[model samples]
Every structure is written in C-alpha cells, then in structure tokens.
Target: MAREYLNVRVDADLKKQLQKLAKRENRTLSNLVETVLGNYAKRKSS
Candidate 1:
C-alpha cells in the first residue's frame, strides 16, 4: 500500500507519551499513529 506524508503539530508532552507507548509496544511511530487514527475514525463513525 502507498502512504502519503501528513504534517501535524502536537505538544511536547503528547509526543513524549506517544514515543514511550511505541517503545513499550514495539511499534513504530507510524503504526502507532495509524492505530490511533483508525480507532478515532471508528468511534466518530459510530
């Protein structure tokens, strides 16, 4: 699958938390972001 680049601005604390979660879960930043976005879409749709 092809992926496009997205530029988003987030706070330092949020970035740090996301990095910690990615490291703990052995997931890449991209995958973590994708999972969060997918979940958000599902919740909003329903």
Candidate 2:
C-alpha cells in the first residue's frame, strides 16, 4: 500500500506514555501509531 503522512493531535500525557513504550519495544512512535490506526480502520470497516 502507498503511504501518506497524517498529522494528528494527541494529549501530551498519552504521547509521552506511548513514546516510552515504543522506546522499550525498540520501535519508532510513528510505527506504533500506524499499527494501531491500521488495526482500528480495518476493524471498523468490517
């Protein structure tokens, strides 16, 4: 699939928490967020 940029606004606390988790998992925060959004879009489309 072709990739596009998405600019989203999120709460600071949530962003920090996710950033920490992403670091621990050895993944970029953008990759983590994309995984979550892709899963959500697929589930909602079904």
TM-score of 2: 0.83
RMSD (Cα, Å) of candidate 2? 1.1
The segments of candidate 1 whose C-alpha lies over 4 angstroms from its true place after superposition are: none
Model 1, backbone clash pairs (residues 3+ apart or across chains), number: 0
lDDT, candidate 1, 1-46, per-residue tens: 8988888999999999999999999999878999999999999999
Q: For each candidate, give its TM-score against the true structure.
A: 0.86, 0.83
Position 20, candidate 1: lDDT: 94
lDDT string for model 2 (1-46, tens) is 8989999999999999999989998999999999888899999999
